[model samples]
Target: MLPEAEKLQFLKKTELFSELPETELKSICQIANEVAYPADTTLFEEGDEGDSLYLMVDGEVSIIKAGTEVLFFNEKGYCLGEIALIDNKPRSATVKTVKSTQFLRITRHDFYNAMAREPRIGSGMFRVLNDKIRRDLEIQMSAIRKEVAQEESMRLAAEVQQSLLPNQEISHPYVSSAGYCQPANSVGGDYYDYLSLPDNSIAIFLGDVMGHGYHSAMVAAMTKSCLQTQIPFDASVPEVMKAITRVIEGSRTFIYMTCCYLIIHPDNRFEFANAGHPQMLLYRGNNSEPLELESTFMPVGFARFCESEQYYSTEVEWHSGDLLVLYSDGITEACNPDAEMYGLERFKALISEKRHLSPMKIKTEILSDLRVYQQDESTTDDITLVVAKFL
Candidate 1:
């Protein structure tokens, strides 16, 4: 049994009883029993039904969750287990004695009787519980607000990135071109553009930066600027590639991009260059098989090459209804839920199946098929595809 005077002294120091007069504290002391436990004793395990409260008088105890320490209490007059008693809920965490200790245990029935007689005891504990609940809610609300802000920022960035792309497909008397680009995220690194040359030839360029994100997007934008300003429309395919290579090499940022640039003339002859990019598919009129126009040079920004390092271009002649396909590795490397790649063979078959369609229709069909193949799976990279057909 605990001494009445000692219990009264400890109760006066606790938040729950400090507001009460000596008479009420003495009344509460009647319902509480003195309990003692050895070091390392588990007072209660998590999830156990709780029907009592513990007021620490001496020694230390720890509250643990999932084998990790949540908190520790060693000071006299500290109270615990009151939350569970008030809520009539299971214990939220395991409480173990850190050393041989003594505390006061008040059972649910006696506690309620004491509160009925002294309403101040119930009011004090309820105030503490309310404050704890409010703090937890505030923390949760702050986390939600931060997540919403991040999402909004990413949405805005996505809009800006989309604006940098061509507004629509281009149609000409000698050539009709259509292109599609999608990032694996809100912003990506794949790029495609069509330029009207001065000599009645059309330049179509498609490229992919090494990866996706702000750095890759920045590099893609830099590539666009170099292609538009540093390289001229009349420049030969090799000259165009070299000019882009030189620009990237001079930049302070070390980034590489794979690109395919093609210039189509009125005579149905197109000069094409590839910089360590995927091979271009040239389908002759009324033919199902696509001839691969392979890359003859290395990827740009790979390393500083000597002036003597040679880059070459491929020239192909075609007739009306012939189609040219240029794409990034994203399409070929797209994976299904099973981790199987949508490989080059499947891409070529899709192209062959849709070869008779218009450039815009072909672009639509290929994207539709890609979506089907990647059902419920996230795209692993930025995708870009450009289709140009001789009219």
Candidate 2:
């Protein structure tokens, strides 16, 4: 047994019992037994039922599992056996002495007696344990809240992107148009819009931004506003594209846009200008092969000169039952479970198969095929499709 003076010194070193009065410390020392064990002693094995708590006075103890030491407690005030004592369960891990060690063992009976004698001491112990538990719970709850906030932000961005899309049915007597956009994520960089001009011409735009996420979503919004300012229906496709290029090039921000603009006349003829967008697919009829109209210039905003020669124009006379499909790279780049791309061949086959279907039906079938092929893999790119058919 340690002398009262030595016991008081030891108690003072332990923060857990440091607040107790000298007399209380002496009382606790009377019931506690000092024990020494040699190196390599099995202090307690996993699955053993423990009835005593131990405080280290000297040397080290290793808490181990499956031959691996999980923790090492070498400090004078380090305590163990709390889990078994509080839960009344077997030890979950083994403890062994790394060298000759001195320790104080407090039996369950002695601990309860101390608690029963001073309810305030017991309350202090309970408060410490409860505070630690509450702190851990708060940390876990904070992580959950952060995750929820991110999802909410993404969902709101998606709704805003959807709001920017053009209405499905154009009210013009001579022209009929429909557009669809599917973002691989909650928000995407792909966008499409249609506007009716005062002179009875229709202005249509399809663009794909360089990246995805919040920045891309913001750029998409800015691009929509720029298009509104630059392209009135009276403007030819080339003029409208030039105006858009000017807006993007003038911005101080680092962003680029790949777009195609088309102006449709009431007489059933249309003119289009391309700016590094994917080829536009023209399916002449059910049995005919699709014609790909490739872009001639670099994507918009990359060059200051904005050479007009690089821009190209095309005119096509629409006939009843002819289908015009405009799409972003996302559709052709979509990968299946086997890592195969849904390339132009599959696109042609599907369009040929569904050519008799209405414009809406063709869009639905293509999207459905894309989903099934990907097997619900997360989308890596934005997808937009615009369909114009002569009825």
Candidate 3:
């Protein structure tokens, strides 16, 4: 058994029990078991029926989904496989120890028993689970953005993809935008565009459709046509998103596009919606940490996230010198020679360090860093990034 004070302290850190009243926490500490294991120990694997969840007191864990290691957590206070205990579902990913690790563990039986004693525990857990479901869905969607081998027949597809690129420069007095796409294949599935609206506001979007070849390119082209058509009719974030959704769903193909589309006005108001894309970062001047706009819904063509086929946008103010960063999964999920991902956290830290640079200069630094980080490994997917800076 671990020290009572240490157990209580780490248990308080787990999101599962973090918000519970102290009395309840102490009650949980009674049922919690302290455990330790060496590196490479299997906590659980994908497809296993989950019986327990763990809170890391201190240690490292790798999360593997479908044979690929997707994420790792060394951050103390992070919860592990939490929904498994709550829902009793088969594990969606495999989790294993990467270092000699310690955990505060609560099995399903103990969890239910504790909840039976205090109904409030279940209530708080379910509240956290609601957020967990959304977050897990986004993580799953991002993993699906992997690259596959393209056929030699995709030469014309390459030409079509090249046609999909919008002007790489955004020229406006109050705002500046720059985008870059470095395809790993002859035909890249990434696309981005911006249009100056009749009202003088600007609509900007970046999209990544998975897979390669002609069909993917055609679907992207169709999506572009839909976007242009919709803006003239209804440029509201929801309506334009719906139009894009219709084009993709109507295609009846096995592809989906993750997108972050935003409308920024001269008055400093910007509205955007993320459809299962990676989180967009908003850096206010020179703040060390960014305000993250996380994924708001399922990917565009996976239209089930829509309530009555309508979408919603998040609004935020863009102050002078604020930088908005949008990117494809390729950039953040790139693996190094060791098969370790460069990772989203590392990417964010890089941006936070370079938030003061002009958009194009920041773009240059991102490519520079990626090259240095990737070293001997050739990336399988396209590298795409967009940065908008308000002056």
Candidate 4:
């Protein structure tokens, strides 16, 4: 048996009963009997009817379920057998002492006695436990809501981004064009657009922003709108790029765009300009070799001082069985599970083997090769490609 003064000291230190008055605490302590058990003794077995609670005064106890220890409790104020005290439920887990232990035991009868005398204290304890249960439920519900919102946002952004791209197939009197874009994630920053010039010349453009997600998607949208407003059929590629650079420079957010633009005329002549974009490939069926049209200047938004005529143009004869491929860096830089890059060599092999295939087939084959090589690895970059076949 514990002395009256020591029992009161224990109750005063416990947060749950600290608010109780000294007289009520003394009455509660009178019903709590001190017990001792040898080491490795089972205090309560699983599935046993629970009718009492235990407060450890010394030594340690382990709560075990299915022969596996789940929780360990030590220290003077640790309480156990809460299922009995809270709801009169069967013991959900077994408890055993790690060493010789002393505990203050309180039975269901004693608990009812205290509650009967101080109903307000009983209500306060129940309220605190109820609030904790509600908080856990609320946290789980909030996590589910956040997940659903992110998925919906991605779906909507992807639809908007797709609407900004050119149609699947475009046919003009002089040339036929087709392109494909597959974002590694739900949204992307790569964009491609084609416009028929008033002078019967066809203008084509492909650009990629620096990053992915909503911020990059928004930048791509703004870039397309800005280009449409600034460039006309008469405007040279250099002039159009300069206008785009000016717009991006004025914004506080840092963003850069790599672009390749080309204008094709009726006489099979081509004028091309590049800004830090991947080299455009031109495959001539007559000769087994492929021509690489390389980049000439830094990407857009890099230059503060704009040059009046910093563009280059090249003329090429368009005949039957000619293929031109323009693509984003995502294709060549793709990595497999082994960390090997799908580099220029693989690209050249695919093209060399499928040179005779149609524009759509070539596009399909390239993407198929990328997926096979990646082998279930998630794509880390946005994939975009454009193919123009001269017929």
- lDDT on C-alpha atoms for all candidate structures: 0.82, 0.77, 0.82, 0.79
Which residue runs does candidate 1 get wrong by more than 4 Å? 1-149, 232-234, 251-253, 305-309
- What does candidate 3's lDDT look like per residue over 1-391, in tens digits? 6787877777776666767778888888887888899999999999999888787877899878777666777988667777777666899889899999998888889888887887767666876787667767766765564312223346667766777777558889778988987677776778888888998898898888876445656777887888878898899998888888877877755678898899999998999999889999899976888999999888877764345445888899989999999999899889889988889898989988988888999999988898899996998887789999998
Which regions of candidate 4 fall more than 4 Å away from where they truly are? 1-129, 304-320
lDDT of 3 at 6: 76
Ranking by lDDT: 1, 3, 4, 2
lDDT of 1 by residue, 1-391 (tens): 6678988988888877778899788788887789999999999988999889888899999877655555667978777788888778898778999999899999988888888888888767876677657644654565566567778977887887777788877778978888888998888988888877878888888888888897777777777777788556446777778777876787687778888888888886888888889999989876778999988767888857444347677788978888999999999999899999999999999899999999889999999998899886899899999998888
Q: Candidate 3: where is the Cα deviation over 4 Å?
A: 1-153, 304-309
Better of 1 and 3 by TM-score: 1
Model 4 accuracy (lDDT, Cα) = 0.79
**Which of the two candidates, 1 or 4, achieves a greater TM-score against the reference?**
4
lDDT of 1: 0.82
- Please, what's the RMSD in Å of model 4? 13.1
Q: Tens-digit lDDT track for model 2 on 181-273? A: 887678888899988777788878899987877777777788888777765443666667777776677767767888888877878778887
Estimated TM-score per prediction?
0.63, 0.62, 0.59, 0.66
Best by TM-score: 4
For residue 27, what is the lDDT in candidate 1?
A: 80
**Alpha-carbon RMSD of each model:** 10.6, 12.4, 20.9, 13.1
In candidate 3, where is summed lDDT lowest over 10 consecutive residues? 144-153
